[model samples]
Target: MTKFASLKSVRLAGAAAIALLAGAAQAQNSPPGAEMATEAYLRAIQEKNPVLHAVIAVNPHAKADARALDAERKAGKIRSPLHGAPILLKDNIESNDGTATTAGSLALKDNVPGRDAPLVKRLTDAGLVILGKTNLSEWANIRSNHSISGWSAVGGTVRNPYVLDRSACGSSSGSGAAVAAGLAHLAIGTETDGSITCPAAINGLVGLKPTVGLVSRTHIVPISHSQDTAGPMTTTVEDAAKVLTIIAGSDPADPATNDADAHKTDYAKGLSKDALKGVKLAVARFYTGYSPKTDAVFENALKDLRAQGAILVDVKDFDEAPIGKAEGLVLNTELKADMAAYLASTDPTKVKTRTLADLIAFNAAEPKEMVWFGQETFEKAEKTKGLSDPDYLKALADSKRLAGPEGIDRILKETGAAAIIAPTTGPAWTIDPLNGDNYGGSSTTLPAVAGYPHLTVPMGDVTGLPVGLSFIGPAWSEKLLLNLGYAYEQATHHRKPPAFRPTVAP
Candidate 1:
């Protein structure tokens, strides 16, 4: 039997071995129960977070919220699967519970919007406790090309839970690390391209970037409207699915989400261990072979999939189709327009910097924000013509068509497959303040720009670091992806809790 099968047999034997394994798999904090786990996480945040720097603020109301949820449960009122579960939000997502949504920049330190983002509201409505906000890349890594992945003036650097000195990846770095380290059961992370998947892969977590507009973006900080999305980062596929079920729906305020209510469903309801049986999955080989170790892990994952009765088809050199070249222009144009509109909508007294130009000036005046990286992207964005520019319009249209209809859609059509799979990214590299992030090959761009669903599940480890296998599908295919991920997770059980080591052992 395989090692995972042996573990399953051991777990079936009794509670003693299971308890022992659970203790070993507890990462930085043990999970005794929800309440106890919350307390332990809070304690860890106080004791160990100085070095990890994963959390920017702790919710003073977390305990109270948990208590309220407990009372509701005792009264026989279970709200959802995540009822009473403590969840961390990336600091870019606004919440009204006295925590500021800073987006890891000093300029927005006092910019409390005094309301929860609509997606946040959905999570809260499902009885998930807000455990406070975690740090992210400064301005979601858009302010500077040279900016470090996990560093921000407000939150320092978020360390990888598996290796303290390694990069956590960003701009959802803290959310990934915190969930992997057992700081929280779940976290909400925003992604424009690789922000959610990269960090989730490196930190050994399951991340699901839902179809853009599946979750409302209202009151969340802006990026490119075409590609931006908030997703769930969790330790398990089941938890990610549960969170997605709660958060996915249409919001009247966000016009982009008009179709979401029709698409959203109970994503976790039909998960089965035999989900991959007879399923045809196209393998996107573009990102493979970058690292022999990562490639080996991926090969083993393929073996596991085949063992589970999945039919894999190799699709080499998937057409990127000028998507990369056009992506920057679209983002730059939208960043200038979207950011200015968001800032203007905020309370003027609370957000003094009402435009991207104002933010550029604020950063120039603040030495701490520019200590490691300058705002070159911000400067370029400021110089862009308004969204009416023909170049901007053409770039957006071209990028969407290439990445969506003619790219992922074409691949799916040709392969006659339900989804495409690839390595999410290589393992974490050493954190470098002076040099910034050194990311390896990634499969996040096409699905991200296509506004499609992308799910990453921990495939296995390379050396001592973790890697993930991605499942990308057309829009509103979250349910199909989640089912496949859940099957793979059950078969391999590749995810292990982080040890919080100082570094990889030589």
Candidate 2:
């Protein structure tokens, strides 16, 4: 019994839940370090919160550490904002003793790195407990073009707690949805592109995609060293700031982290409800007007920011020039080399797919894996030369030129903005099995391709689905964007838990 045999197993179970637990709804709403809020439902789903609980250590760790935090509170010491909190960690992040760092693929089942990813260790030291591992898109959704976001061959499908039919968003899907569904107060998510921000946006959680070097990637699964980074996904900007402080630093193991220690602020220290005052922001108009409804939410958010003393500049000069296509080329070329290196270091046995080629073969053998999407992305990557290739070099150069200096940097320099803003993504569309995702434009590509930092706060809602307002800026600007985000979050308070709709009938 791997917990769930199918998605339909809990459809009625979830719907019926809202009916019987009317009174207990508010009772289950316990904050991180608050007194026990009458453990009505949280206890029942402690270990059974399969998709949301990212690690298996939650029970033992939560039991012991939570009490310790409570004792500290009684003794007048609140270790940190997340002092008595529980968090889920993505499968790929290393845990010193308890959980294995498999990246949701069987190839590295025994590849538990025997130490927490440096970022993970810092958070635990700050008093956050590792509850369990949330399933992720296998190899962070790099396996095949047809790959599903939340589905891993080892962990199966991590259903959206809000809707049994809709997607949970990949790579960091579990982490995003877990925190959104209240399985944990926070979770660790890694991203190369839309991995962290996309999921967080769609799931209505706050996600911080730090600059590539801000958080160490050591002991975690590798995507592309140039783009991969770890970040926090939490219910609030304040909590996200707390987690960022604990996890961010330069690591000797990850050379890319050399500049991180000096860059990241105790981000929480600067979070203020009034920091949005007199701030200048530019909106990438090209990324907007995709969905009239999402635009409506974003439009309202603009008004809110203005009311809060922020200036919104409708910058039409921001480039949207075919960046995604170019970035795809670089990802394919780099994934082949980076993933191969990571695979070579892992144990071969017990691994479902070893090399990228082997994984392709496995998917071919199992049609279900190839049914939803094709391995086109993986196949293309296989054909790409190493980063040293002239074509690869050209694509990389063009990306930095267009997405960086000529892109975000150019806009910031011209506007003198504290940050640029956009709709993180449109509202969650109806899940279409035949055609796949039908969402609108996303603001992730620019920041993602540039390896710059991007943070999203709740904007508002569209037919009850959440919309995220993104604040993107140059490297190490996470603190500035976070402060502006915190100010907006505190002022608007747009975040709301999902109602678990079965499907949005179109």
Candidate 3:
């Protein structure tokens, strides 16, 4: 049975508005063109956004851009299967469109560069419409340790579409919620660690954090230069693969992506339903068993994989304490350095928070910025001596060594497994401002710290909330992981559209 059938149907209250708009737009004699599709989404946002707060700004040029793409199609040009499809950019990613890349902060509300990030350029070149920018955790959730995941000063909090009171986990929250709710076909989200995958899992979407250097991190707001990368967040693994194909190439401005051109490929073409058959997958048992409900769902998913002829290997004992300890130091040290560099790149008049100290003072003065939480994390980053400091350097080297060579690599070699599997995270927790995020479990650190690829696909729900199955692989293994995820996704058919229930009692 399809997993969704067994799940209760709690229909969204505001869905009629979008449904009516979709029907009215496509009810015409001719096929619904890009213009019509853009219009429908624009109208959908108007009717549904007040409740969800998913989108920060709608692109003023979206209709005009769609019309242009339609004219091109009429003139015998179709860039790809996704040509003219509307996609949202997480507010941290800059685009040439009129929308400001605010990073969900009131401080950078007017910090519009009016230039596309290299990845955004690639998407536009492929004829994808820039529908708008979506909200996010303020400053990508780096300001405070006690920060709320989906709340932001500029765009407000992003509500999970599955259950309105649930948290849409971190940084990429709006992008995840918007795509899951059908606000857009896909969205681009940046991740320093679990930012992309967490929100994607909680919101019941497919999120792929590619090998760090595979996609350029040129114009997105900074967190950690060594770890940050932009990736696709979509409802389907195929859509994520398609977006990765377009965006995976070298950018001259980003030194990290120097080898990207050599590694890039048509990722979507490599997918096969039989890819998982006879493949040995290492199950990261340490990452599971946090929530019994989530583990139960994962066990059923494992059964589905086994039924498909995949071999599951159990390798349970690995200590993750050193990696976690080292990662915090590396992130704090790099954030101070990378943030200053990015701020310097911005126009001086538009962005006044030119240094970490400047941002700290701004938050101190602005009541809205500090009303919900404090900027203790930012202050700690400011106190770090420099990226060149001995302790910081030691932490950086130690983290990479522990997470990459001694970590995922050693496990794979010992098990002779193609990849590692884990529960991406537990189901979405309640949105709480008083105490901040209460995570049940996460398997994001190994892949994230190692700068390897991690793909998360919806496995099933815990109660009324969704959880994701994670595939973790070595560097530049995005294609392999995608194929594996696609195979599992096709076999299970697990993804379900959100019901937008007010809350789940359990």
User: Which ten residues in a row are the worst by lDDT in model 2?
Assistant: 32-41
Q: Which regions of candidate 1 fall more than 4 Å away from where they truly are?
A: 1-34
Per-residue alpha-carbon lDDT of model 3 for 160-194, expressed as tens digits?
A: 98998999998899999988877877899989989
**lDDT tens digits, residues 64-150, model 2?**
555565566556565565655567788888777556776866556666555677887887777666666777887898866556677
For 434-485, candidate 1 gives per-residue lDDT tens digits of 8887877799999988999999999999877999999999999999999999
Model 2 vs. true fold: TM: 0.86
Please list the residue runs of candidate 3 whose C-alpha ends up more than 4 Å from where it truly belongs after superposition: 1-32
Best by lDDT: 3
Best candidate per TM-score, number? 3
**lDDT ranking from best candidate downward:** 3, 1, 2
The local distance difference test score of each candidate is 0.86, 0.74, 0.88
lDDT of 2: 0.74
Distance from true location, Cα of 361 in model 3, Å: 0.4
Clash counts per candidate, in order, are 0, 12, 0
